[model samples]
Target: MPQEPVFHRYVALGDSFSEGVGDPDPTRPNGLRGWADRVAEELARRDADFGYANLAVRGRLLGPIVDEQLDAAIAMEPDLVTIYAGGNDLMRPRVDLDALAARYDEAIGKLTATGATVLMWTAFDAGWSAVFGKLRGRSAIYNELVREVADRHGATLVDFWRFGEYQDLRMWDWDRLHMSTPGHQNMAIRVLGTLGAPHRIEMDSLGPDLPTDKASRRRADLAWTKDFLVPWVGRRVRGSSSGDGVSAKRPTLAPIS
Candidate 1:
C-alpha cells in the first residue's frame, strides 16, 4: 500500500462562515464550534492526529483579516488552511472588483508563502435584491478573481456560491445569513470532499431544491433585514460607508455590530 499522508496541523482563517456563525452547538460553553471545529472533528474520525486552530472573526472583510490573522496563520505552520470570506465585501454599498481582487491576492500570497495547502471558499449568493442587486455582476467577477488567485497560489477553491444555488435556503438559519446545524454539516461534507477526502456527500443529497417553500422566502427576507439592512443602518449611522474595512483583531465572538 502507498504510504498514508500525515497531516499534523490544520488552521482556519476567514469570516463568519468559517467560524460556524449559526451553529447551535456551542463547543466552548460560551461559544459555537463553527465549521473549522466541525471539520476538525471529522478529520479526527479518520484517525488523523492534528491540531486545529480557527482564527476567523465574524464580519471580517479581506484586508483587515489578512493584516491581523495572516501572521498568526503562518506561525501555525499548518499542513492545511481553509479560508471562507468575502460575503461582507459583497454586501458593501460600493463593490469595487479590483480592490477586492487585490486584497484576495495579498491574502493568498501571504498564506501560501507559509507552504501550507490552502483551501479557499468563495462567497455564497444570498439572493438579497437590496444589496446584491446593486452589486450585480460583481459576484461572478469576484468568484473568477478568487479562482484565478487560487490557481496562481496552487490552492484549492471550493465554490460555495454555486453549491448554495443548488441547495435549499431554508437549511440556513432563520436569518438566512448563516448556516444552521444541518447546513454546517453539509458544508463540512463538501469541504472535506474538496480536500480529497473520500467520504463526501453530494449537494443533492442534502435536501430538495432551493426556494422550496414560502418559509424559505420568509427566511431570506429576514436574513436580508438582519444581516444586511440592520448592519448597513449601523454603518450609515456611523457615516462609515467608505468600505475601508474593519480591524480583524476584534473579538471573534462579537456579533457583527
Candidate 2:
C-alpha cells in the first residue's frame, strides 16, 4: 500500500511578484506560477510534509489584499504565512503612506492572531529614474513603513528590495518590475534561506533543459556584482568629477565593536 504524504500548511498573500509572474510554468489548472509556488515546490521537495496555498493576485494593492486576501489566508490555518505587498499601493496616484501602513499593520495583526509564524518582505526602489520615478519614491516610503510595521508585529522582515537590488536587472522582465524566470528561482532560494528550510535540490536542478553553462553563471554573477557595486562607484566618480571643495577620500566604514 502507498503511504499518505505528510503536509505542513503554509499560506502566502500579496500581489504579482509574490505570484511569480515569470516563473515559466503555469500553475496546474490555469493559474500562473509565481515565486510563492516555486517556494512551495522547494519546501515540498526538502520536506514532503510541506504544503502551501498562495492567495496572491496580479495587480492587487493593499486595500484588496487586506480586505479580501487576508480572510482567505487566515482560513487556511497555516503554520507559516508570507506577506509580500505594497508595490501596487506605491503605483497608485496620490498614495497615502500613513493609511498604507495602517492597512499593513491590520493585516499582519490578523495573520499573527492565527498563531502562524509570519515572514514579510520590503518593497523595491530602483532609484527613481524618468520612468517610474514617482512609483519608486512611493515604494521607498512604503518600504520604510513596512519596516516599522514588521518590527511592531514581531514578524520576520526579509528585505526583498535590498536582495533584489543586489541582483541583475535582467532578473526582471521588460516591464522593469515583474521578475523573470531566473529571478523567481533566485528568489525561492533566498526565501528558503530566510525560512531556515533544509536545502535539497538547487533551483537549477529542477529545470532539466535549462543549461547550467559556465558562461551563463559568470554573466549572472557579473550582473549581480555590477548592480550592487556600480552605483557606489558612480557616486564616487561623480563627486570627484565635480572637483568641489568636498574631500575625495573613500568613505570610511564604522568599526564593528
Candidate 3:
C-alpha cells in the first residue's frame, strides 16, 4: 500500500481569486480569508509542521502575477503550490489567448520542475452572467489552454469552468466577479477533494432561494451595475486597479496560527 502524501510547505499564487477578494475577514491579513487559507488550515491539521504562504494580490493581470510571484514562490521550496491566474487578463478587451497561455505554461513548468505538487484552476465560465456573457468565448479558449497546460505539467486541475455549482447567483459576490464566502467554502472542498486529502471542511451543496420576480431581479441587477460594474469599467478606462496600493497578504511561509 502506498503511504499517504504529506506536504509541509504550501504557497498560493495569482490574482483576486487566490487573494480571497469576496471573502471578507477583518481579523485576517488584507481583510480577507479565502479558500486557499481554508485549505491551508486543513493541511495544517493533518501536519503540525505545515506552513502556508499566499502571495496573491487583487486586480492583477497574468504578466504581473508571473513577473512578481513565480520566482518568489520557487525560492520558498514549497511542497505544494496552487495558482489561479489569467482571469483578469481575459476580462480585458484585447488579450491574445495564445500568448497568455505561453506565459502561464512557462510558469507552471517552472513550478512543477521544483518537484512540488502543483495545482491549477480554470477560469470560471461566465456565460450565465449578463454582465460578463460576452467574454464567454474568450474564457472558453483560456480554459482549454489551461487544461492543456495542466496536462503537460502533470498538475492537479480544479476544473472550475466545468463546475455547474457556480451557475447559481449566490455563488458570486455582489461584483459578480469574485466568489462569496460560501463560494470560497465550496472551492476549498473541491481543492481538498482533488488532492485526495482528508479534510473536515463542510460543503453546502444547496443553492439559496433567490427572488424569482422579474422586477425584483431587475432592480438588483441595476443596483449592482451602478454600484460595482460602473466603477470597474471606470477603473479600466483610467488604467487603474483596485490593487494599486496593495501587497501580498502573506509573503512568507509560516505556520498557520
Candidate 4:
C-alpha cells in the first residue's frame, strides 16, 4: 500500500477567478474566499503543518500574471501550486493566442521543474452565454494548448472546460462574467476531487430562481451592461485594470485554516 501524499505548502496563482471575486467572504483574506482557499482548508486538515498563499488578483491578463506572480510562486517553493489563468485575455478582442500559450508553457515548465505538484485549469466552456458564445472557439483553442502544456510538464490538469454543470445559469454571477458563490463552491468541490483529497464541500442551493421570461431576462441583461459591463469596458479602454493597486491576498506562506 502507498502512503498518502501530504502537501505542506500550497500556493495559488491567477486572476479574479482565483482571487475569489464572486464569492464574498468578509472574514477571509482580501474580503473573499474561493475554491483555492477552500482547497487549502482541506489540505490543512490533512497536514498539520500546511501553509498556503494566493498570488491572484482581479482583472489581470496573462501578461502581468506571468510577469508578476509566477516568479514569486517559484521563489516560495510550495509543495503544491494551482494556476488558473488566461481567461481574462481570452475575453479581450485582439488576443495573441500563440504568445499566451508560449508563456503558459514556460510557466508550467518552470513550476514543474521545482519538483512540486503543479495544477492547472482550463477555462470553462462558455457555450451557455450569448456574450461569450463567439469566443468559445478561441477558448477551446486555449484549453487545448493548456492541455498540451500540462501533458508536457507532467502537471496535474483540472479539466474545467469539459464540466457541463456550468451550463446552468445559476453557476454564474449577475454579470454573467464571473462565477457566483455557489459556482465557486462547485469549483472547490471539483478541484479537491481532482486532487483526490478527502472533502465534504457541497453547494448549498441551486440558486435563487432567476427570470425565465424573455422580457425580464433582457431587462436583466441591460442592467448588467449598465452596472458592470460598461464600467469594465471603460477601464480596459483606458488601459486600467481592476487589480491596479491591489496586491496578492496571501503573499506569504502561513498556516492555512
> Would you give me the overall lDDT of model 1?
0.69
Model 1's C-alpha root-mean-square deviation from the true structure amounts to 5.7
Candidate 4 structure, TM-score to reference: 0.96
Taking the tens digit of each residue's C-alpha lDDT, what string does model 1 give over 74-103? 876777888877777777667788788888
Best model per lDDT? 3
lDDT of 2 by residue, 1-257 (tens): 54433237777777777766656554342235666666677666645556567666666767877876788777668777888887766754467899889988988988877878899998765663334555666777788888998888889888877874434555666455677776777777787777776555354432233235899857755764577335534744564311123221101111111
TM-scores for the candidates = 0.77, 0.71, 0.97, 0.96
lDDT of each: 0.69, 0.66, 0.92, 0.89
Sort by lDDT, best first: what order? 3, 4, 1, 2
Q: Estimate the TM-score for candidate 3.
A: 0.97
For model 1, how many clashes? 1
Better of 3 and 4 by lDDT: 3
- Residue 1 lDDT in candidate 4: 50
Greater-lDDT candidate between 1 and 2: 1
Residue-pair clashes per prediction, in order, are: 1, 5, 0, 0
Minimum summed lDDT over a 10-residue window in model 3 is located at 201-210
Report the lDDT tens digits of candidate 4 across residue range 1-257.
54556888999999999999988899988899888888888888888888999999998988888899998998998989999889999988899999999999999999999999999998888887777888999999999999999999999999988889888888888778888888998999988777777787777797567779999988988998899889989987998988899889999999876
The lDDT, on a scale of 0 to 1, for candidate 3 is 0.92
